[model samples]
Target: MAAAEEEVLGLLVGAVDQGTTSTRFLVFNSKTAELVSHHQIEITQEFPREGWVEQNPKEILLSVYECIEKTCEKLELLNIDRANVKAIGVANQRETTVVWDKITGEPLYNAVVWLDLRTQSTVENLNKRIPRNNNFVKSKTGLPVSTYFSAVKVRWLLDNVKKVQKAVEEDRALFGTIDSWLIWNLTGGTKGGVHCTDVTNASRTMLFNIHSLEWDKELCEFFEIPMKILPNVRSSSEIYGLMKVGALEGVPISGCLGDQSAALVGQMCFQDGQAKNTYGTGCFLLCNTGHKCVFSDHGLLTTVAYKLGRDKPVCYALEGSVAIAGALVSWLKNNLGIINRSHEIEELAKEVGTSYGCYFVPAFSGLYAPYWEPSARGIICGLTQFTNKCHIAYAALEAVCFQTREIWDAMNQDCGIPLNHLQVDGRMTDNKILMQLQADILCIPIIKSSMPEATALGAAMAAGAAEGVGIWNLELDSLSAFTMERFEPQINAEESEIRYSTWKKAVMKSMGWVTTESSESGDSSIFGSLHLGFFIVSSMVMLIGARYISGIP
Candidate 1:
C-alpha cells in the first residue's frame, strides 16, 4: 500500500505585496494567521532627471507574477497543494499611480512614483488656486494639496506627457494606483480585466470622499482629472474577480488595501484608539478613531483604516507620515558607499551610543506630517570635524526615530487618549538598535510584530475574511501569543525631550531651502529657462484654468 500523503492542515490565502523598493507575494495559513511561504524581487526605480522617479509599469506587473510562482513552488515543497489557495489579496504602496490604455493594456507612460517631486510646480499652482490653508481638501478627502497624493502626480502626467494627455482626451486612458493596475492585468488585462480599487486605496487619491465613500466630482474637476478614467471604488474586502492564470488560477482576488492600512489591519487594531507604526522606505503611524473621521488640527492625515466588506461599516484613522525612513539607510549604502548592505547600518550604528550632537534630517523630497514644508531640503547639522560616517549612520537611525516621535505626539493629541504602546512592523523593525531608540525617543513601550510580513498578512486576512474563513479575529483571544514583543523605554522622558529639542534646531535649518530661483536653476525642465517671463506666463495659464473651472468671468 502507498504511504498516506500528508494533508495541509489549514486554508491558504495568497497575498501580493507591491512596495516602493520591491514586489513580493506571500502565502499564509489563514486558520492560524501565519505566513508560510513567500518570494520577493526588487523593482528598479529610474531617475531620468533630478527630483524625478519613474518605474516601468510592465516590470511591476511581471514581478507580481514571478513572486506568486516562486511562492507556490515553496508551498509544494512543504507538501501543500497550490490549488488550496482560497483567494488572492493585494497590498501596494499607496499613491504610486499607473495609467494605461484600457483596451491595449499598455501603460501610457512610466509610472510617476509617489516620492517624485516633479509636481512641485503643480502643487504651488494648485495651492495658489485653493484656500491659504494646506488642509483645503481635508474636510472631504482627508488629504492635502501635496506632491505625495495620486491626483497631483496624475495631473503632472496629463500636462507633461503628450501620449498620456492625448489618451486622456480621447477617453482611452484608465488611471489607477498600483492596486487597480495589478487587478486589471491579473483578471484579464485586455480581455476584460476588472478595473476597480478598494476604499483604502481610493482614499489616498484626494479624489475619494471620506464621508460618502465615493469619488468626489468637484475634486476631480479641480485636479482636471476626468471621472471616466478613474477606477470603480469598492470596499477593501470582496470578490472583485478571479485570477486568470498561474497556479492559483480561478482563485478569487478578494482583498486590496494600501500598505500602511494593511499594517493597521494585520496589527489587529479593529478597536478604536489602537495604533501601529510601519518602518519601510517611509514611516507611517496610524491610530484607529472608529467610525467617525477625525480631521487632524495638527498636520496628520485622516485616512480609511479598512472597510472589510460591502456591508461593513467604514473605520477611520488619524495617520502621520514620514517621507523617508529606510530610504535614508539606502542613501548611506548607495550614495556614500559607507556600507555594502542596507542591514549593515545596525552594526555601524552600534559603534556609537548616540549621534553625539550631530543630526541628519533627510527631507530629500520634502518633509511630510506635522511640518508640511515642501521647500525643505536635507541637512546634517551640528557636525563637528570629529563626526565620522559612523556618527552619520547613528544619526540617520535617530532621524527616523525622531520623526516617529513627532507623529506619535500628533496622534495622541488628535485621539485625546494616549497610545500605551506602539505596535510596530516592517523591515526596519528587525534592527533592535532602531527599535530601542524608537521606544526611548517616544518614551513608550514598542511592541514589534511577530509577523514581519504584516503588510502581506493583512491583505491575506482581508481576503480570507471575505470568504468567511479564519482571519485574525478582532477578539484578543484569537491572537497568537507569539504575535508581539515589547521593548520598554530605556531612557527617561526628560532626556528624550532634550535630544528631541536639538533635533528640532536641525529641522528648522532644513526648511525653506527650495526657493523659485533655486528650483528654476536646479530643475530646468519644468521652467524651460530661468526667465521672469516664463514664470509669469505659467502663472497666467494657471489663473485662466482656475477661473474656467470655477465658472468665474
Candidate 2:
C-alpha cells in the first residue's frame, strides 16, 4: 500500500501553456512523459487600427483558468486524483506587454501583442538616439530594437494609458510580459503576488542584460520606462511560487520559460549547436550556444536559452524568427478562401510540381531575423500564363522554407558552425510536403518529432527536473519517446543556392513594393495592393489564353 501510494504521488500535474492566440492545459504522465489530458481555449485579438493589435488581459486570464479546470475535469474522469499532481509549469508567448495596477490587480489597457507595430514611431525615435551597433540593446540583451519587444510597448503604455500613468506616478504600476502577468494572477493577484519573469522571457525584452541576467538600468532610462515597474528576473526552472487558489490550489509553480525556449527544451536540444524550429503563428529557430553569448553580426538575435539555477551561467542561443509561416496559410484560407482548411495547403501545393516562376515573400508584418526590415510587405512575383492556384499555394509553402533557410544561414554565421540537422515540431510540421520543402531549401536534414507538442513537453520537463523526478542529463530516449521523420536534402548545392538567390531577389522586390505603395497612398493594406498585381497578371494570362485559342502564339 505504501509502495502503491508512492507510485501514485509521483505523477506529473497539468502544465498551462499560455500562448499568443490560445491557452492550453496539458497533463503529462511523469514515468512515460506522455500527455494524458489536454484542453485549449482560443483568445481573441483586437486590431483597433492598422499596425495596432491588442488582446484583453482579463480574457487571457479567464482562458488560462478555464483550460486548467476543463483539463482537470477530464483527468478526474480518467480516475486520476488531483492530489497526485506534483507541480504546474508555465510556457508563454514572450514580449507581449501587459501593465496593471498593483493595487486593484486590473490591467490599465489591452495587452499589446508582440506582432503589433503601434509602437513603431516610438521605436524609430528611440533608434535615432540609440544606434544599432554601439547603443542598440541587441548587443547587450541579444534582441533587436523592434516594436515586437516589451520595452517599446511598455513605454507606449506608460506614455498613453491614463490609468497606467496614474499608477506609475503613484508607484502602484507593474509591467511585465504575459508570463509574468499570468504568474501574478495565478499566485493571488496584487495583494501579495510574486512579480517575476524567467531569464529566457526576460532576454527578449531588450531591457535585460544578457551577461548580467538583469534588467539594464541604462536601457530602462533610454526607453524612459521606470525600473520600479519591472518584474524580478528568475530562472526557467525552480519553485517560483505556489498557486494560492482555484483548480491548482497550493501547487508549486516550479518552472517557467518563454514559449520558444520551452519548445527548445522540449525537443531536448541539450548539446551545443543543437537546434529546434517551432512552426507556430510565426517560425522561430533557436540554436543553443551553451554559456557563450555569440552576438549576431548577421541579423539574427542572441538570447537566453534557459537558466536552471541562480548561480548557473545562462545558456545562450542565436535565434532567427520569420513573422509569417503558419500565419501565411491562415491568411490564404481565411482572407483569400484559397483552401478549405490550413492543413489542406500541403495537398494543394503538392498538386503543383513547383511555384513555376512565382515567389511569395510573406513579409506580412515586416521581416524579422536575417532581414530586420520593418517596412517590408508581402509580394507574389514572376506570375505568368502557366501560373495557377496550385502554383500560388506551392509558393506560399516555399516562403516558409526560404525564410527558414535565411535563419539557418544567419545562425551559422553568428555561431561559426553550421547545424547538422534541424529538429522541428509544431502543428505545421504535420504537412509532409512543407517539411520536405524545408529540407530541400535548407540543404539540411529536417527532423520532425513524433510529438508535435514540444512546447508543453518542455514545460513539463522543466517542472520534472525541478522536482527531482528526472535529471537534466537523463537520456531523452528513456524519457519522452520521440520518433523522427528525417527529410534529407535532395537538391544539389548549386540548385539550392540559385533558389536562395531568387528568393533574395523576390524579397528585395517585396520590400521595394512596400516602399512604393507607402509613398503612393500611405495605405496600410499593403497585401491588398500586392494582390492587385496578381489580378493584373491573371488578366494578362487570360488575354494570352484567348490569343492562343484564336491561333496566335
Candidate 3:
C-alpha cells in the first residue's frame, strides 16, 4: 500500500525561466532533487528603431505556455504524472516593463525591454525637473536615475503611447514585469488574476521603496503614472496564486524572482557577502548583503535579493549590471560572421595568446554599472593590420571579463569585504578560455557550477522551499546537487592592473562620443567626427598605457 502511494504521489516542482532571448521551463523531482525534464523556446526581440528594443507581451505569454506544454509532455513520456507537479516557480528578465488593459487582459503595446534606451530623454527630463541634491529617488530606491529602471519606461508609455494614456485615465491600466504578467495570466488572466510582483522584481522598478518594500506614491506622481496600475508587492517564495489555465492549471504558482536574484538563491548565497555572477544575454553580478540595504556609494544598485515568505527577513544585494556580455558573442556570430556557433568563439579565441592589442567595448545598449553612460556606443580599439578574427574573438571575450572586474571593484568599495570567489553560471560559463581570462583579469578565483542553467534551478528551489523540499531538506544538500570547478588567477597583479588600465582608457574614450548637440542636429558628425577621432586616439592611448603600466620601455 505504501509503495502504491509512493508511485501515485511522486512530487515535483516546475520552474519557468523567462529570459531576454528565450523562455524555458524546467521540472525537478522533489524526492531526488534532480532535473527530470526541460524545454526551451527562443523569444523574438523586435527593434522598431535604433536604441529601442521591444517584445510582444502576448507572444511572451504564449511562448511560456508552450514551453510548459512541451516540458509536461516530456514528463509524461517519462511516466511522471503531470498532476504530481505540485508547484510552479517563475524567474524572469528584470525591468522589462509590460502594461495592459485591466478588463480584457490585452497588452497595450510591446514590452519595453530593460536594455531599451528610448527613455533616455525622459530620464533626463525627470532629472531636470527635480533638484540634483534632493534626488532622494536613488537613495530610497537603490537605483540610479537612468533608463534602465522600470518607472521611466512607465512614464515613457504614459507620455508617448495614446492607448496607455487613455487606459491610465480610465483606470484600466495594469503594469507588471514579465514575472507578474506571467503570474496574472497563468492564474486566470481576466477572470480573476492575482495582480502582484515579488520583492526582488519590484526592487528593480525604481518606483518601489526598498526600505519599506512598498510602491512609492511620490515616485508615481513624479513620473505622472497612476498607482492603480501597479502590481501588489509580495514575498519571493510563497503561493502567489494557482494556475487556472495552461498545462499545469491546478498547480500553485509558489515562487517568483528576477533572474539575477533567482541565480543568487540557486547558488545558495543565503549568507551575507556571498556573490554570484550570471552570464546570459547580459551579465548581472549580485552580492548578498543579508538584511542591510547598504546604499552603494558606487553606481551599483541596491536591490532585494529574495524574501522566502511574508514573515521571512528580506535579503538585500548590491548589484552591478552589464548591458552586453554574451550578446557580444552573439553579435560576432550573427552580425560580424566571425564564428558560425557561439561555442566556436572559445577555439577561435584560443588561437591567439591574448587580445593582441585589441579591446572590444560592447556598449551596444550603453554602459551599465560604474559608468552608467547612456550615450556610449560599441567600440573596438587597437585593431591593426595584424588583427584577425581570432583577435577580435578574444577581445569580445575579454570585454565580458573587464566589465565584470569593474563591477567587482565597485562591489568591494560598497561592501568593504571583497568576494573570495565569483560564483559563475549561465550558458556562457562553458567557455574555458573566457573563464581563465576572467580569473587572470579579476585576479580572483572563478567558481563555475556544474549546473550552468542556475536561473531555472533557483526558481525551482524557491518553489520547492516554499513547500518544504528545498535546501532545508536534510537529505538533499543544495551544494551536493552542484559540483564546482575553480579557476585561479594565473598572471601577476602588475600584468592584471596593466591590462585593466588599458581597458579603462578604452572605456573612457567610448564615452561622450555622442553629444546632445550632435544628436539633436541629426548630423552624422556624431559618429563620423567625434567617434572616429576618439577611436583612433583611444587605440594609440591603449597601446601606450599598456606598455607604461607593464613597465615595458
Candidate 4:
C-alpha cells in the first residue's frame, strides 16, 4: 500500500523449518542476511506403545499455517508488507514417513516418526536376506538396515494401516517424508501439488539410489512399497512450486533439504572435512565429503549433503547421529524433577565439581549411529550415595559429549580423515561448559555461530542460491558480522582417550541390561530407577495439587 511498506515487505523470504519437535517460520532480511521476524509452534508427539513414536500429519499442517501467519504478523508490525514475501524455503526432519491418499490429499495414518522402532522386524527380515556389508542398498544409498530410515516405516504402514492398504490397492496412495508432505500441502495439495523431494532428503529414505539419484524399484519391491506412491526426486535448490494461498501468496518454493543437511549449509561448511553438529531433539553431525561417497566401515552413514541444480554435481556427507541430546535435559526436568526447567540443568551442572564418576547413557529409544543397537536401553553407571542432582545434571551434559565423541571417531574411521575443528549450532550449544567439554572430549575445537538459527539460515541460503541472489557470497569483511565462538581442546590426548575408554565400558554394561527373555520374565531393569523417579515426582506433584485444592499455599 505504501512505498516504505512495499520496500520492507520485499525483503521477506520466509523459511519454514519443520523439525522433529516443532514447526517454525522465519522471515529473513535477505539483504542484510539477518532474521527480521520469526515464530515457532511445538507439535504433538504420540507414543502409542513402547518404541513406537508418531505424529499427526494434519496437526503438522495446522502448525505450519500458524507459524506462517504469526511470522507474517510480526513482519507487518515491523512495517514489512506481507505481500513482499518473495519465496519460501523448506527444511524438514528426515526419514519420518507419512502416507496419504493421492486423490484426496488426506493422510491415511499418523506419520511414523523417525525415532519409531516398530519396523525393526521388517528391517531385520530385510537384513537377513541381504548381508550388512554387501547389501546393495547400503552400497547405493549409503545407509545401514535400520528402523530409523523411511523404508521400513513405510512398509510397516502399508502392511498395518488399513486405510493405507485400501489406498494402495486402489492406486491412490502417496508416501513421503515430512519435507515432501509439507511441499505438497504448501503448493496446493492434490489439485496441482508436486509429489517431489530433494536429493538430500531422498538419500536418507533407503529406497532412493544415491548413485543413480532416483528411487530404486528393486529396493522398493524388497520393502514392499509401491513405486507409484513415491515422490519424484529433485535437487535441493530449485523452483519446485509456488505458494497457491497463504499469508505470502504467489511466492515460489525454491529450496528444500533435510534439516541436518540444511544446517551444514547454514554453518557454511562448504569444504571437504568441514562438519557441523546440530543439537536438538537429537544430535546430528554431518561432515561434508565433497563429491566422493566413502562407504562407512565404521557404522557412519554416507548421504547427500545437497545438490545445487539439476544435472549439477551432488555433494556427499558422512553423518553420525545421536538420538538423544537436549531431550535428556527435558527428561531430567520433567521426569526426575532434578531441575525446575531445562535451562537450569546447565546452571546446576556448573555448580557441581564434576560428574564424580557417574556416567548417564541416554539410550531411552535405543542407541543410534555407530552403535545401531536398537535394543540398547539407557543406564547410569558408577552411581554412589554421594551422587546428587548436580552430579546427574553434569553427567547428562557429559553424555552428549561422549556420544559426540563416538560419532566423531566413527566419522574419522570411515573417511580416513582427521577433523581439527567442528562447527556447532542449535539450542544446547549456548552452554559454554558443554561446548568446552565437547571440545576437550573430541580433542578438536568447537566453533559456534552467534546465530543459533543455523537451520533456518541454511534453508534461506539454498532458496537465495536457487534464485541467483548469492546470499552466501559474502566477503570476509561482511562475514565478521556473523559472530562465532571457538572452544579449543583443553585436555591432553591421553587423558581424553582414557575418559573415552571409561565411557565405552559404561555403554557396554548398559546395553545388555534388558533382553527378550528377561523382558518376558518381567525382570527388565531398563527404566527401573529412572521410571521410578518419574512416578515419585508425579506423586509429589499430586500431593502439592491436593494442598492447593485445600487452599494451602
TM-score of each candidate? Answer: 0.92, 0.91, 0.92, 0.91
Among all candidates shown, the one with the greatest TM-score = 3
lDDT by residue (103-138, candidate 2, tens digit) is 999999999998876676677677788754686576
lDDT per model, in order?
Answer: 0.84, 0.81, 0.84, 0.82
lDDT of 3 by residue, 471-522 (tens): 2242366445677899999999999999999999999887865654343233
Residue 151 error, candidate 3, Å: 0.5
Give the Cα error of residue 333 in candidate 4, in Å: 1.8
Provide the lDDT at 166 for model 3: 90
Give lDDT tens digits, candidate 1, residues 125-191.
8888987564457789988888899999888888878999998888889999999999999999989
Off by over 4 Å in 4: 1-10, 131-133, 467-481, 513-553
Q: What number of clashing residue pairs does each candidate have, in the order they appear?
A: 0, 0, 0, 0
- Give the per-residue Cα lDDT of candidate 3 at 238: 82
RMSD of 2: 3.9
TM-score of 3: 0.92
Q: Better model by TM-score, 1 or 3? A: 3
Better of 2 and 4 by lDDT: 4
